[model samples]
Target: MLIYLSIISIASILCLWSEKSYKKGELFLSGFSTFLSVMVLSVFSGLRNLSVGIDITTYGKNIFETVSTFGPSVAIDYYSRWADTGYVLFNYIVSFFTGNIHIFLGVSTFVVELSFLLFFKRYRAVLDPTLSFFIFNVVTLAYSFSILRQILSMAIIIWVYYLLTKGKYLSAILLAVGSVLIHKSAVFIILIIFTCYIITKFKEKINQRYLLLLMILFTLLSTIILTRYPETIDNLIDDLNISSIQLNNFGSPMRFILFLFPVLLIKILIKEKFIQNNEEYFLYLISLITMSFGWLGGINYSLTRLTYFIIPIYILFISKKLKIINKKSINLIIIFWFFFIFWWLIGRGSEGGVIPYIPFWKEYIVF
Candidate 1:
């Protein structure tokens, strides 16, 4: 774990320094540095033990083996018994090349990270790429070590969101549909995009305070509904065709804080006139809505997974907002943020099966 932190910290520094070169039009230097950072992350994550993510041994490996041995039609039919179409198809394509699970994992890691880096380069104007990348590594990247398909869906949704922001509505919608095929959770992305569109169209008539209050009310209502009618939630999950294997009865209070703090911070920044962007505001609202739903339906693990869809947008908003603050204040903020991330990585992160890091090579040797 220490090694992971050390490497990520170094990468963050290099990325921060390279931002200067990016501003000076030194495209090759900036691109090379970003590529190196992403490569380190991809290689490390791809090569980790199947045990590292709890699901890899129980679910991922089995799925890959099924695909390799049975071929796409059989594999897809088997997985479609429980999982979504996109994930099963993904496995089928990868499995065609190699029966080795490690190769599948390696390919997945490279594809996901490369897609993210390409998107980041195109949309870095929305946020400081360095800070956005750093926050992603610390707060959300490890979670991908567990839920690979969902993370891939998230990457696709992010790209779709970028397209929507650029007025490429047709492309965004098409891509969003493709994302939903990957993971049912991505349906929330489509829902939220339409929600944001309506809100923006009525920005003049709508009261922000009323909107916040409505969100709180909606959250409470959803909680009541979830508690009193769990079957309804179950039916909804079934309707979406999502896996219901990992349902939990308790909410993650600590994770709730982790998701909520940046949200409130962004609100504060907006109120102080330090930041003003409709797209950021839209993302903030979506994060609040989804996270509130997660808290409300805390017993339903799939609802929490929905929160991952919008987290990238929140990271971008926070990163951009941080750039507008005074350097001294930003420094203090960075200190606190780093401490929180480090503490999470050492504590809860490990508890969640993301630590005691073992590379694929090491695990292979031990076996």
Candidate 2:
């Protein structure tokens, strides 16, 4: 617990420093702080004991060992049976240099954090990247610690968004495909990207209120269908040959509340006219879509994970708009998030299997 809290505390200070530097137009100082913040987290994540995340012991080390023992081609061929080809290839490529699992973990986390930093920088005009990074650590990074492949896929998808925003469509398209190759679940996010494109293309005709209502209605209807015929979802997954995925009857009420809070916050931003242009409105819509996925967690608990892809989006959205909110309100919001993150980090570390944090050095007795 000391290790975990100390890491977050130090990173949080750097995040604050970064935000202050940016506000003062000290670009170099801000960038340095931002880089340091990310590196601090990335290094900690990379150097954690192999037993830290459940998946590390269950699959990560196995795949790393396979590549080290039998070479890349055989390891790739063997794991490709059930694992993602891109992920296997990634492991093999990383294994090619050194078989140290710690190196692989560090490198993978650096990629994820770098992609996220780029995404935040792309929207820096509308967001405080430092604040967004802090929220990401509290809300999403723990899960990333465990779900390595999907998190890599998530990073690639986020990079795709960054590329698209920069008008680099060819690169974006290639990376979009790459994300799916890394994890099939990325197909949902690809659909989201396509839907967002359609929404943006027709922004003049799209009614944000009506679209939001429709999304809420759809979520409610999905919940009913899931409750009435749970087997329908099961059968669909089975037919898709993804029986590896499991289903749950209902999601946690705490999660429902957490997801709903963001929707309400977005509505407040819209009501206050904080969303001034089509681009901002489009961001609002994407935030709505992201939160709605969490609402539909009633359909399958796993559906909640779909929201992970948009963590950067909604965080950027809120950070951008919250500037208009009163300082007291902002403080309240921060307090809410602090409590939520505390509960999540302390109460449910087991969920991500990232608790009882152990540094790799200690685990290996190298110190």
Top-TM-score candidate index: 1
TM-score of candidate 2 to 2 decimals: 0.83
lDDT tens per residue, model 1, 1-367:
5655665677677677668779999989987877677667777777788877756763478877886787656766665633467777788888778878877777787677667666655656646676666666666666677777778888788888778777888898888888888777678667876677668545755456766786788777777776787676565344222223233223456556656776576557556553355665676566667557546534555565566677677666566666665354764575467457545633444423667677776863431
Q: TM-score per candidate, in order?
A: 0.84, 0.83
On a 0 to 100 scale, what is the lDDT of residue 254 in model 1? 55
Model 1 stretches astray by more than 4 angstroms: 81-83, 234-253, 274-277, 326-328, 331-335, 338-346, 349-352, 363-367
Per-prediction backbone clash count: 0, 0
lDDT (C-alpha) at residue 164 in model 2: 64
Residue 253 of candidate 2: its Cα lDDT? 52
lDDT of 2 by residue, 33-146 (tens): 878877888898888888777568635888878977786677667665343678877887888787888878888887788787767766667666656666666677766777
Clashing pairs in 1: none
RMSD of each: 4.1, 4.3
lDDT of 1: 0.66
- Per-candidate Cα lDDT values, in order, are 0.66, 0.69
